[model samples]
Target: MPSKKEIEEVLKLDAEKRFSYTIKRIADFEFVWAIGDQHGFANYGDDNGNVAFAIWPFEAYAALCCKADFANCKPEAIELDFFQEEYLTDFKDRKMRLAIFPLPTDKGILIDIEEFEQRLQKELDEYY
Candidate 1:
């Protein structure tokens, strides 16, 4: 397994522009990391009463791996609303729609952005 520093280093790649449209972080609870400062990902209900997208770990991590806005993605259909409300960004080109979620084991797991992309695409093809 990669050390925390090594993993952190790898997860720090810039992966915006890869996905169409812009994203920025929001002032919401989903943005908060799980216990131990470890973050999770999953869309939750918003004031608008819609299911939004939520990326786990962090945005840069999501970008580096080629994952789409967790909410914008759906195998059922390529509908943006299927994901989160609006994506988040720390800076220009360094865009993302990430979130911090809770892990069942209470252990944070760094997500595979690439794998998330693949699975999402498959979901698009198979379901959507």
Candidate 2:
């Protein structure tokens, strides 16, 4: 799991090119995560109920790169289906569900940045 500081650094590096897409751990699953954007404020789950990992500028760019498969990734041309139905589904038999809202945003995990980071870190630590 990436630490808050690490995430912050990554976000900082990606600042100029804001990564509006978000990837979050699926609720009720141990190793399921999803990738999506913040549109319509759709609720993937209860606010602050599930743990969201990262919000990247490129779709599945972080997940693929984190898996050390950077050579095969083309973020600019990546699609959600490329990740959801193909890659992420292998982790679990069901579909990959992603929340529509960004972290620390209203209607989903209403909290400050520090608290959000702390909660994510805590959940990750406990999971490991």
Best model number under lDDT: 2
TM-score of each: 0.25, 0.22
- The lDDT values for all models are 0.31, 0.35
Q: How many steric clashes does model 2 contain?
A: 3
Cα displacement (angstroms), candidate 1, residue 102, comes to 3.0
Candidate 2 lDDT over 1-128, as tens digits, reads: 45667566544443222222132342113333334333311123444465333333333324443223223332232343454455434423432233233333222222233443344455556556
What TM-score, to 2 decimals, does candidate 2 have?
Answer: 0.22
Give candidate 1's error at residue 36 in angstroms: 17
lDDT of 1 by residue, 13-56 (tens): 33332121112221211232211112433443334444334343
RMSD of each: 15.1, 15.7
Please state the error at residue 99 of candidate 2 in Å.
Answer: 10
